[model samples]
Target: MIEAGKKIILFDGVCNLCNNAINFVIKRDKNDVFRYASLQSEIGKKLIAERNIDISKIDSILLIDPKIAYYHKSTAALQISKQLSGIYPLLSVFLVVPQSLRDWVYDIIAKNRYKWFGKKESCMIPTPELKALFIDQ
Candidate 1:
């Protein structure tokens, strides 16, 4: 697991889109500002319970910044975009568009994700080079 103060991304490991999104963040996060965990893992479950988060209502991305706070769905995506390098950082502008509208779009994509992107039978195995970046359970 990451140190207490570091930011961590909790995601759906079996979802292809979610997996690709994690890779996208990994590539743009030049500062290495984030760590990752699959929402299905023991650590992910423990974090949810500790935070008093209702897993049944949240199936999208979650960004946890320890004592600072956490963000879900569109908010999480925008918060992460702000930390990325290059044009990726520009995506943060979408935050001004009103959360309900943005999340409506996000929800559409999320709801259809498995049918559209396919799923892995098991969790992803990070490559040896990027192994250290993940928080193993």
Candidate 2:
């Protein structure tokens, strides 16, 4: 389980796009507000099961704000963006759009992510320096 104040990011392990996004977040995580876990990992699975998240319906990015709540799909991405440094937080302005519309777009990209971006044979192994950023690496 995550600590009370920290946020958790659950991502697809083998998806190249997901790994790249993790790297991007790590670079901009100036205050280290996030920790990560692949959806296939033990903690990831336990969290999902506790929340009763149906993978068939929503299997991609998920953000858990420990005691607060969990966010999925475009909301998760935009919420994450709001936590990053630089111009990225501006992306949360898109939240004014309807969630259904935003999720529609997110779904399209998620569905085709593997076909468009490909996948790795296994989950990324965090380097020693980054190991602390991941819970179940």
lDDT of each: 0.89, 0.92
Winner by lDDT: 2
TM-scores of the models, in the order given: 0.95, 0.96
For candidate 2, the 10 contiguous residues with the lowest summed lDDT are: 1-10
**lDDT digits (tens) for residues 12-85 of candidate 2:** 99999999999999999898899999999999999899998897887789999977779999999999999999
Candidate 2, residue 60: Cα displacement in angstroms equals 1.2
Q: After aligning candidate 2 to the native by TM-score, how far in Å is the CA of 44 from where it should be?
A: 0.3
lDDT of 1: 0.89
For model 1, state the Cα shift of residue 84 in Å.
Answer: 0.8
**Can you list the residue pairs that collide in candidate 2?**
none
Each prediction's total of clashing residue pairs, residues at least 3 apart in sequence or on different chains, is 0, 0
